[model samples]
Target: MTLQNDLQSALGFLNQGKFKQALKQSKGGMKRHKSHPDFPNIAGISLSGLGKHRDAIPYFKKALALAPGFHDARKNLAQTLLFLQQGEPAMKLLERVLKDQPGDQAALYLQAQAHLVMNAPEAAIVTATAALARDPRQPRMLRLRATAWNTLGDEKAALADYQAAVKVNPNDADALQNASLLLARLMRQDEATETARKAVAVAPQNVEARRRLASQLISNGDSAAARGQCLALMELDPKDTQVLEMLARISSRDQNAELLPVAQKALKAAAPRSLDRANVSFALARIADQAGDKEAFAAHNDEANACMAAQTPYDYEGSERQFSRIMAAFPDVITPAETAPEGPRPIYVVGMPRSGTTLTETVIGLHPDVFPLGERGVPAFLLHPCLDKDQDFTPEAARDFTADDISRLPEMPKGTRAYVDKMPDNYRLLGHLGTAYPDAQFVHLCRDPRDVALSIWRGYFSGSSLTYAYDLKAMAHRFNLYGRLMQHWRQVMPGRIYDLRYETFVADIEGESRKLADFCGLTWVEDMAHPERHEGQVLTLSNTQVRQTAHTRSIGKWEKYADVLAPFIDGLNPEIWPEIKG
Candidate 1:
């Protein structure tokens, strides 16, 4: 085949996600016309698309070498470098691109997302805002701004940007999907459902959108429709693990064992991810237990346990530095105005993503006098004063503060003394939380690092924001860093943080709740044992699980699969409640 034809085929395959084929074709094209003007450029695009990032570097360099001013090739090369985890180099190219063409949409979008992920949200917002100004209706740009807003603690603004993007591009499946997820959490059930429905309608063949809408419906108590949607999604992508898992979870009436076969099917096919396999196995076991098939339940649980991956310690020096930079950028936890607690009041629960945060929040919510904010951004993340205008935040994160902003913060709500901000990722800003409400008690929940690692891997998270979560070792390192930070907070900001344990809570709910109550300076409420009964009160992701109360079954359930946890089995800190590590 001619160089051009091979390149064309490579482009086609690249766009189709047939990376291997694209790589093959691009290599073939390069060999045919090693000297062609555009061949190197095509080779660069195709090879990078193929994920042969290192090999593609020369091609992009060659392309730029041949045509020094080719914006398209330059842009592709820059982004390709970023994809190869070469963020600094990519930043240099993007900066050059922006210097040349300040209003370049692709450059701006790429630069913004890149910066956001690299702990440069202020820079991301700056570029993203410029991108939006040039093309206000650009779906990607809008989402970029929304994300930047989110990272900077402007939940309302983020929602507004996302909503606007959805409005401008009603058929944008991603926009609809995110809007649904966000609104659902914000307690706009009807809007969330409608938005998700619209997303499914617009992209009828999009199995993901269908699944999302269905899940939202299920959460909103529209299980009947959720089941139908899940079934429909199954029809399109029969083995889509997410669809299969959701179906298995929803169709409990179809004989608990029935879903097992489906889950097994998805698992056998390597349907989506390892997490799905774990979830399916767990769900099947749950059903078996319900069905009185103890042996079968044990077996399934054991198999699910087998899915536990191994672990290795990560020498994530670069990541550590980046995290340090992010911490430096947003140093203080921006909190609501109520600096001093006059009495027992709303406590903000801040920690990492899966650190026993939800459980701690639920315990706090169990208090009769306190209201549960769940994970909603009420005194929202964006409520921080520094979010105004455009400032890319640094990882060495510091609060963008002013005396006036502090002055304007609302006083303690009439009678509500304790409000909980259960932003798990808010640990990086613990001091800010302290400053936000000197009187507010901050509970920093910690769990076994191994359990957190295994849990995250065995779950489907936003694979984008938390790139670290994809790898077990990275997850462990991140967890360790979090532990170090919490430990530091205790040393410096002692008395403000109450470390909660997952195992202790499981072993003795009453004991833990009373301890929690004492920590928050509240009278222990007897009703906390029935955590699920306070369903409406939970605003975090645990809404579904909190329908009744605490269940002892979840604690230490990892034992069923403890043997299978190869990758992250022992990645936890050696001193994590030394009594329990054994």
Candidate 2:
């Protein structure tokens, strides 16, 4: 064949996804036409297609060296760098390509991807928007833009972009799955379920597709359908720990004794030190508890805790030091009138994990004038950047918050009197929050330390922020720190915080609900007692418990596990012991 024909044949194979055939043709062409960069670039593309990203890099570099002005070769090199996780170099090269050829859609798309990886969603949005402007119908660019919107917490924008992506590429399983998950989070379960079904239909053999379908079904409270998906997933890969974990959760939810054997098998087969082993052990413990095998339950529970503690050791002293710094920094608290930031004042529902944060947020959110923002880190993000952690936050330093810091907060929706931030751990941020939004209403949830400790210990937490929760000593110490912090807040700003005891709230929902509404400057309404009536996803471990009517079944649950919680009781503060124990 002529050189031109050889190139055309190689290009056809590459475009058809016949990587091996393309590689063979390209290699033969490279030997015959040693000076051409296209053959080398094609060879790199084939190697990359075969998952040899590192091996592909040298060929890409060779192509770029031979033809410095070849935009295709440079773009190919950038993509290969991105595939190999060399993000900085990839981004620099992509920026160079875009600088030279201002409307290169491929370079813009890859630059957007690089920004997403770097956690710069704003930058990603800019690049992705530019790409879409150049070629408005590109499904990948639409999906990339959707991701940037999602990361920016603009779900409506993300949903619109995802819808556009699916319209452009109906068979895009990832777009379908993302749209479904977002819909689920937005509490549009029916639409989410349909979208997830479409994803599974499009990619029946894809484990992630099945997993997402199962997740959507779980959110929709369709355990039977979710279990079927889990079983199908198990058939595809029985040893998949995530599938096993999902099966265990579904079986536990249904209280199905028949599935106990699956949990046992998973526990026995999991590696001794793996997080999966710990999770499976916890599942077995719950099953054992249900079976009335107290000893077996305790053993499994302890093993799981030990595994978790090993994996994520608590920094108790460091936490104490940080708390002390916060306390000393803001010793003299300013009154609500001193700081001046306008808009609907924030109501922070702060407490320990498994405390009444979700319940409190739900009840308060029921009020007509209140909007629930639901567990945002915005306050912390703003406040932390101003704090010089090494230096104490003196009254002078506390006054350092400028209007620009406050302006970063978005305006509340029209007619909303206030918005609630229900981050449970915001208990630790009360002092800093007071400095930023002195007029901010604080609703602090105080639960029985024993119940709180037990609940936290038994639950599955995903982040390092709660590393102390898995061990009784760490939990008790953390609780002690919490108590000290609360006491400091009360001392510094007397009568400023509305203390909502969980037991009192649970026992007299209507009365506490009315009083809380009064505290938040709202008139009493009967609807305040039915938090479950409110819309929006609850994204905490308390999600299941919060959806039901207010009940006292969990009031003294730690009593049943008293023997297991002896250490927690002993380690708790002597002054607070009576109230917690009773």
Candidate 3:
């Protein structure tokens, strides 16, 4: 065959994951045409096989330079960019490829990939949707579409796409594996388990598929099946962090200690990524607590304290003022939002992150009728109309919801007698909620702005949404806005708002718990004392803390990190501290 034909054949071999065959074919092809345009592309693929990411970039670029229309080389370059941690630029590069070749299935797929890495689900969905429109049969595109939908808070849409992706490519291990994960998120445990099985059925070599299946089985409450899946996965890839995390979970379940180190080592080897740190840290701490090592216990405790950083309180007067405007403009949906809800009168968990809202919610949830569903962000998703990108909340907007808006609550939350809506950032949407459920209870949860700032700086939230979490001054400005708007809510909705202090919740748990229960229309119960009893929902980054139930451990936990937080919350008006403590 000619040099070009041989090079194309080599690439086809590479695409099939036949590294040995691809390397041989590529070597032969390059020998035939040492200076050919495809030589660099072939060499890049071979280098990538050796885990030489940095070295592969130039070769991919060379291929593109020689053959400017080489779409495959561009895709490889984008992949290399992602590995280099230059994700935003990589996305732009992928976008350029798509612009040059509209309807290019591969380019579109990579673009969706870059969006996911950047944590922009809304953007992910838009790009994924366009990609899907052009190539519905591409299983990877379908998977991307599903992930994008999930990020957009469209659970049903995500499931549909996942299903389509797997159905179109049953042996596509990645598709099956990812589809199963989305199924678990949708709470379809049994189906997810089955889907995970199918994933491994095709690609038993794909370690991640096995891990995903194992996790789904465990979530389904089928511990045995999950463990079996874990075993199969370990046989395939013993160094997988997620699989190790699962093994640790199983070890704990069976009262076995051997798997603990195995899990820890795997995670550490993975370089301690961001998303899984909260869960892993909590589990690791639990492991240490079992070993009777006080220092380990202290470190774990510190981790819990550290996790609160994502809970940055508000900043900027404009944000809060805008939120207040939104709340005031909020039109009431439920005609009798005031009725049926009695007791602690529903302690509405308000305040920005690091504002002690979690502590407040934990204390209150301990009360008999109070359910501390950690960070159930459903309220925030449904109350989007009230969220203006940058516009001040206008009363005209609040009254604009139609019948569809009012019907949302009964549809979303299914069954519950006056449950607490703990959407922290909901302060901005509270007024809209007021109109939606006019009679629904409210609690303007707060904490000393300084303490809130300190709490945030010390804490490490795995799923942070803003850049503010990493910047103190800017974060403080954000906190000021949230607090100030909260202040506005108290003023306009006088006698309607009550503040719960994070510090006071620990200092006076019983009293606060009692008051909080009453606020939320719940009859008191002794079980509320052990907030740890209510577990299993991975609602937010505080999964570990919520799992242990609410306690005073996190309260005043930032005393060590105090010096760091002082500058941020100190900028906020002091008027709110008195309100939170009382």
Candidates in order: C-alpha RMSD to true structure: 8.3, 4.7, 7.6
* Residue 540, candidate 3: alpha-carbon lDDT: 41
Q: Which number leads on lDDT?
A: 2
Candidate 1 vs candidate 2: the TM-score winner is 2
**lDDT of model number 1:** 0.66
Question: What is the descending lDDT order?
Answer: 2, 1, 3
Per-model TM values vs. the true structure: 0.63, 0.80, 0.62
Clash count per candidate: 60, 1, 43
Q: Mind giving the per-residue lDDT tens digits that candidate 1 earns over 31-87?
A: 777665466776676666656778877878887877787778888888887776677
lDDT of 3 by residue, 1-582 (tens): 897689788989788877667767876876787667687787788778767788888888887887888888888889887777667988877878878888877777777778778887777778878877766787777777777776666666777787787678778787777777666554455666788889888987888888777666554445677778877777786655455555555555334366666656644643332434544554565566567664664565455334433344324564556555565553342232333322222335777775656545655555544444445445565546446453433444444342333322222233334445566777775565565455556777555565565545434444545445655676766765666666666665655666766667656656766776676666667655555565333334344455454556655555655555555545444554444334
Work out candidate 1's RMSD over C-alphas: 8.3
lDDT of 2: 0.80
Model 3 lDDT vs. the true structure? 0.62
lDDT of each: 0.66, 0.80, 0.62
- Per-residue lDDT of candidate 2, residues 392-466 (tens digit): 444555555434334434344589878888888887777767766767889999888888887887776776778
